[model samples]
Target chain A: MASHTNENTELGKLKQKIAGLEKLEQQHKKVEAKLKTVNKQLQASENQLKAYNEQLRESEQKLNQQKEAAEQSREFAESIIDTIRQPLLVLDKNLRVITANQYFYKLFQVSPESTKGNLLYNLGKNQWDIPELKELLKKTLPEFSAVEDFEVEYQFETIGHKIMLLNARELLQKQGKERLILLAIEDVTKSRIYKKELERLNKELEIKAEELQQILYITTHDLRSPLVNIQGFTKEMEASLNDLKKLLEKMQIHPAEEKSLNTIMDEEIPEAIHYITSSTTKMDNLLKGLLSLSRLGRQKLTFRKLDMNRLMQQVLDDFEFEIGKNQVNIEVGNLPDCMGDDLQINQLFSNLIGNSLKFLKPEVPGEIVISGGRVENGCRFVVKDNGIGIPREYQEKIFGLFEKLDPKKPGIGLGMNVVKQVVEKHNGSIEMESELGKGMKFSIFIPD
Target chain B: MKKELKIILAEDDEGHASLIKRNLKRAGLMNEIIHFKDGQETLDFLFQGKKDKDEIKNVASLLLLDIKMPRVDGIDVLRKVKQDEFLKKMPVVMITTTDDPREIDKCHELGCSNYITKPIDYDKFVAAIRQLGLFLLIVEVPDLNNMI
Candidate 1:
C-alpha cells in the first residue's frame, strides 16, 4: 500500500511543471504582437511631422516675398516724388525737415551739404516760417482737398520778396507712428504781374473806345454841310452853254481849274466822294447797331424753335443784289434747328453771307454752302464759301476788330467782330476752318 | 430841228445867272432868253393850275435846275415837270458844285437827263456851261403838243 501512494504523487508534480511552461510561451507571443503594432504607429506619426515642418518653412518664405515687394513700392514712390525738378520738402512730426530734393536746395540758393542737418526755417525759400507752416499744415491736412489755389504768402529778401503758392499734405501709414508732411512751392510773381497788366490794358481800351466814339461824331458833324454846297454849283454850269470852241477857250483861261477838274474825273474826287458818303453811312449804322447790341446784352433772350432751311433761305434773299452782280452759285446742305434767338440770329447769317459776297475774288466764280447740325446743348451752323481763304496764322485773329485780311474790300473791319460779339452773347463759340485754296468754313454754335 | 427856240433861267444868285446866260449866248445858239429870280414865279407861270394859250406860247425847251432855292426848290420843279405828261419830255440838267457821287447817282435814278458838277474858277465855269450846251444838242426836247 505504501508503494501505490508514492507513484500518484510523482505524476501530479510532473503535470504541474508542464502547465507552467505552456503559460510562459503564451505570454511571450502577446508581448511580441503589441511591440509590432506600436512600431508601425510610431513610423506614421514621424512622417506626418516631417511634412508639417516643410509647410511651415514655405509660409515663412511667402511672408518674406510680400515684405520685400511692399518695401520696393514705397521706395519707388518716394524716389518718384524726389525726382521732380521743383522745390520739394518732407517734414517729420518735430517740424524739422527729414528730407529735401536737390531742387529745393537750388531754389533756396542754399547748398544741400550745408543744409543737411538744419531746420526748415533756416532755408531762404520759406515764405511762411516753419512754425506757421506747421500750424497751417495741421489745420489744412484734413480738408486740403476742398481748397484750390491755397497758398501761404510771405516776403523773403533772398529770393527778391515775391509771392508764392504753397501746397502741403500729410502722408499716413498703418505701421508707422510718425506722420510726414510733403510741401510743394510755386512762384507766382510773373502771374501776379500779368494779371495787373491785363487789368490796366482793359481800362485803357475802355477809354479808347469812348474817345473813338467822340471823334467819329465830331467828324460826321463837320463833314455834312460842305458836301451839300458842292452839288449846287455843278448844276448851274451845265445849263445855258452850247459851244465847243467857247468851252475850250474858257478852259484855257483857267489852267489850274482844268488840272483840278481832270484829277476829279480820274481818281481822287470820285474816291473822296464815295468815302465820305460811306463813312457817314457807317457811323450812323454803327450807332444804331451798337445800341441794339447793348440792349441785347441787358435783356433776357426769348428762344424759339427755328427752321434752319427757312432761315438760310431768307438770308439768301437779302443777298439778291450781290448774287445778281456776281452770278454766284450758292449751295445748302442738311440743316438742323434748335432753340435760339431769331432776329439777332438773322443778323448773324446776314453778316456772314455779306462777308462771303464782299470777299469774293473778281472775275472768279463764287460758291457758298450752308451746313448745320445738332449737338449736345447746342447746334452748329457753318457757312462754307469758296471765295478767298484766310491765312492759317490769321484765322484766329479774324474775329477781332480792325483785323482786315483784305484791304480792297470796303469795311471798317467790324462785321466779323459784330458777328463774334453776337455769337458770344448767345453763350456760344465760333471757329474758322480753312486751307489756302479750299476757302473758309465758319462754324457757329448756338446753345439750346 | 430848227424852230423858234427860247430859254428861261431862274437863279437866286445874279452873278451865276448872268455868267451862265452870257456863256450860252457866246456858244452861237440864237434863242430868246428870259431870266427870273426865284422858283415861285417860275412854278406860277409853268403850273398854277391854269392853262392859258398865250402863256404857253413862251414856254422854253430846256430847264436848268438847282436843288437849293428860295420859295420852292429846283428838285420840286423838276419833279412836277417830270410828272406832267405834256412837259415830261423836256430835258432837265442838274448843275451843282458838290462832288457827291451818291447825290449824282440819286439824281440819275430819279430820271434826271444829265448832271454836271461846276468848276471852282470863273473861266472853268464858262467852259463847263459851254460843254453842257453841246450835250443839249444830243438830247431831244419835244414840242408841247407832241409831248402831250
Candidate 2:
C-alpha cells in the first residue's frame, strides 16, 4: 500500500512541473509581443525626428540668402550717394553731420575723419556758422519741411567771399525713426560778377554817346559863323570892282593906262571873284553836311513793321532815271519783313543803291541783286552789285564821317556814316565784302 | 502932320553894319541913319539922352537890331525898349544870323514887329533890306515926342 501512494505523489509533482513550464512559456510569449509593439513605436519616433532636422536646415539657408541681399542693397545706396556731383551732407536731428558725399568733402576742403559726427556750425573752424544759415536751419526748415534756394553769402578765410544757394530737405525715416536732413549747395559768385560788369559797361557807353552829340553841335555852329562872313565880303568886293570899272569907262583915260585897267577888270579881278565864290560855296556845303549830321541825333525815331519788298521798290523808283540811263539789270528776290524806322530805312536803302549806281564798272552790264531771309532773332538782307569795289586800304575808312574813297566824288562823303548810324539806331549790324573792280556786297541784319 | 522917320542900326560886326547901310541906301532909303557898334551903346543912346552934337530928340524912329552883340544882347535891348511907354510905339525888326526856330519864336513872343534871318547870300541880303525899306515907307510911324 505505501509503494502505491508514493507513485501517485511523483506523478502529481511531474504534472505541476509541466503546468509551471507552460505558464512560463506563455509569459515569454506575452513579453515577446510587448517587445514588438515597443519596436514599432520607436521606429515612428525616429522618422519624425529626421523630418524636423530637414526643415531646420532649409530655414537656416533661407536666412543666409536674405542677409546677403540686404548687404548688397546697402552697398548700392552708398555708391549712389558717393557719385553725386553737388556738395551734399546728411545731418541728424541735432544738426550734427551723420555723413557727407565725396563732393562735399572735396568742396569744403575737409576729410571724413574731421567732418562726420561734427556739428554743422562747428565744422571748418566755425566758418560755416553764418547768421543767415542759422536762420534757415533753425527757423525756416522746421516750418517748411523743405527749403529751396536759401541764399547764404559768407566769407571764408580759405575760400574768400562765396555766394551760395542752399537747398535742404527733411528726410523722415519710416516707422517714426530718427529724422535726417539732406542739404545741397550751389555757387553763383562768378555769374553775379559778370552781370555787374556788363551793367557798368553799358552805362559808360551811354555817357560817351551823349558827349559825342554835344561836341558835334558845338563844332558845326561855331564853324558856320565864319563861313557866312567869307561869303558876304566876297560879294562886296565884286560889286565895288564893277562900280570902279563903270566909273573908269565914263572918264577919258590914256591908251596904255586903259589897256592895263581893262586887263585888271576883265581877267585878274574876275578870276579872283570866281575863285572866292566857288570856295565859299564849297565851305557852305561842308557846313550844311555837318549840321544835318548833328540834327540826326535830336530827331525822334518812329518804329514800324516795314515790308522790305515794297520799301526796296520805292527806293529803286527814285533812281529810275539813273537805272534807265545806265541799263543796269536789277533782280529782286524774296525779302523778309523787319522792324525799323520808315524814313531812316528809306534813306539807308537810297544811299546804298545810289552808291552802287555811282560806282558801277562802266564796261560790264551792271547787275544788282537784293535778297533777304529769316535768321536767328532777326532777318538778314543782302544787297549785291557788280560795281567798282573799294580797295582794301580804303574799306575801313568808308564808315567814318567825311571819309571818301575818291576825293573827287560829288558827295560830301557822309553817306556811309549815315548808313552806319541808322543801322546802329535800329540795333542792327552790317557787314561789307568786296574785291576791287569785281563787285560789292552788303549784308545787313535787322531784328524783326 | 507926319514927323521925319529916323533909323537906329544896332550891330556888333562892323562889316555887317557897313553892308546893311549901303544896301539901305541903294534901296532909296534917304532917312537919317544912326549907328551903334554894340547893344550896350544903342541902349545908352536910346534910354539915356545922347550928349553928341548930332543927337536929335522927339524923332519917329525905327530899330533894326542884330543878335549876338557885345555887353547887352539884342534880345535884352528889345525887351527893354518894348517895356518903355514911349519906345513901345516904335517898330522893332530882328535881323540875326541865328535861324533857329526857337529863337525866332522867342523874338516874336517878345513883341518884335518882324523877325528876319540874315541870309549869307549877298543877293538875298540886299533883297531882304530892300523889302524892309519899302515896308518902312508905307508904315505910319508914331512920334515918341508927341506921346506924353
Q: B11-55, model 2: which lDDT tens digit per residue?
A: 877777877888888888888779998899998888775454134
Clashing pairs in 2: none
TM-score of each: 0.43, 0.56
**CAPRI quality of model 2:** acceptable
Candidate 2 lDDT over A22-129, as tens digits, reads 999999999999999998888888888888888888888888888888899888887888887778898988899999989888877888999999999999988888
Per-residue C-alpha lDDT of model 1 across residues B10-117, encoded as one tens digit per residue? 666665676667677777655665666777777776664555734554454677776556788767777887888667777778875433444566677767888876
Compared with the true structure, the alpha-carbon lDDT of candidate 1 equals 0.69
Residue A280 lDDT in model 1?
Answer: 46
Regions more than 4 Å wrong, model 1: A1-38, A109-132, A142-149, A186-448, B1-148
Cα shift from native, residue A319, model 1 (Å) = 14
